[model samples]
Target: MNIKITGTGSYIPNEIQKNEDFNNHQFFNENGSKIEYSNDVIINKFKKITGIEERRYASAQQNTSDLAFLSAQKAIDNANIDPETLDYIIVAHNFGDVDMNTSQADTVPSLAARVKHKLKIENPYCVAYDLLFGCPGWIEGVIHAQSFIKSNMAKRCLVIGAETLSRVVDKHDRDSMIYSDGAGASIIETTKDTGGIISTISASYTLDESNFLFFGKTYNKASNDEKKYIKMHGRKIYEFALNYVPKAMKACLDRTRFDISDVKKILIHQANEKMDEAIVNRFYGLYNEEVPEGIMPMSIQKLGNSSVATIPTLYDLILKQKIDNHQIHKGDILLFASVGAGMNINAFLYQF
Candidate 1:
């Protein structure tokens, strides 16, 4: 069975938090107390590195499932498919519906199950489940759905990546500036069409677990309680992305027997602008060519790093012509890549 993405949708919270918002805030240590850092100094460093000017934060009452529902509904509508017709609903998220302020994680029925309920899909055959694959969760979920289609187990699948990172980020930490909340979704179905997912590759480097990113219980001054928050060694991740992501992309292209010059657009995870640019540049460099300026598009400037939701959201924007000069035509070849928390990296070659 051949798989094609029929439609895509995304939702960003209405609330906006600018980089300057962190200027005067005290940086937090492991004990959850504040260290001193001027907001201007930190903000400038963030701008130079991530190109993030601001990020969205979900409302206090909104949960990850809620965001997923919004994005999924738009995708379903765009696909013109009935909710009950979906064979699978895979929701990708690291932390479940965590409290926006408390940073408490909760996944009682699975985010996919909650999304199914909210969509009012009563079909017992419409299996729903949650996937946790670090920040590449959504991409991995898409790869999984393709397997089901290849085995003739499913006809239509809804893959949604939703996260309320604000709840999982310690505002007192500089990393919080890079984390944000949003949802993105896509409808993938078996199609006779020629342009879809052509080739893909995914792998992880986890020989020493301590080297990769992980969540640790930290002090949250806001809630005055110990909470699990995301923490990572910045240098390690930066080096890993620079070294391996380009290799991954080249491998995928080689497997697809497609030339990098033929790719029209590159939609990468909105993790960090500088890192993404470097990854694409290195990939093109392997062919001894200069990286084309417009071939790669970015949303990290405004969206920050939304983990799994980044790629789909960026894809949706491109599909809707929201990004300048970034339009997708039928038969246009595109590249999607991401590397994050799992110390994982993946790339997919797709034609639309």
Candidate 2:
């Protein structure tokens, strides 16, 4: 049975946060003390290094579940399937539904359950749950869906990755500028045809687990309100991406016996443009070939890093021909890869 992605959809907030938006603003360290840095130099470095000029931030009135609902409905409609027909709903998110004021995440209902209720999916048989695998959550959700379909446990599944990073990011921290909010979803079903998800794999290393990335409620003396913030070591992550990400991609391609030339697009996690470009170039180096231009489509310039939502959203945009200079044709091959907080890495090979 082929696990086919029948439809895809994504929703990004209308509120744009530009690079210049941080000018002359005070930033704080983890201890909450203010740190002085040239805003122009920081913005210029961000633009030149990450290629991110702007990103979207969800409004205070919106929640992660809200973003998920919109994208899920669009995907369900695109799939032309009744909501009741879905056998599973897998929502991948990091912080669940964190409020803008408190930065506290609520996980009791599970984001998947919240989406199910919002979508009016009444059937109890349609199992819905949340998966947390750092930024690879969405890809991991797709992997689980494939397993369910292969084992005859499910026929059709809706996989969604949604996040409101704006709610958790520390406004007083520079890293906050790189986080945003968005959601992306896909409806996958079992099909008799061959072209669909070809191969999937995931792995994790915990050596630097606590240092690389984390999210929690922490106090900032600069702000009157308490907030949960994302913290990370950029240099550490960059090194990890350059080393392990390419290895993971190679493992997936080798498992499927496909080469760099066989893939049409490489939709990777929109973390850093420089790191992503380096990883792809290094992957091609493994084959003693130069990296090809236009093979890796990037939306990080506009979307920033929406974590789990990045790859699926990019995939949807390309599939719908919404992204200029990028299009997916029938029989096109694609490779999706991501690395995140758990020190986890994953990859998938697919054919359109």
Identify the leading candidate in terms of lDDT. 2
lDDT of 2: 0.89
- Tell me the TM-score of each prediction against the true structure: 0.95, 0.96
Query: Which regions of candidate 1 are displaced past 4 Å?
Result: 28-37, 209-211, 217-224
Model 1 alpha-carbon miss at residue 252, Å: 0.7
Lowest-sum lDDT 10-residue window in model 1: 217-226
Query: Against the unseen true structure, what C-alpha lDDT does each candidate score?
Result: 0.87, 0.89
CA error at residue 87 for candidate 2, angstroms = 1.0
Residues 100-121 of candidate 1 have per-residue lDDT tens digits of: 5676778998999999999999
Q: Model 2 over residues 112-205: C-alpha lDDT tens digits?
A: 9999999998899999999999999999999999999989999999999999988877666777778889999999998877799989999988
Provide the lDDT at 185 for model 2: 99
Residue 255 of model 1: what lDDT? 91
lDDT of 2 at 191: 82
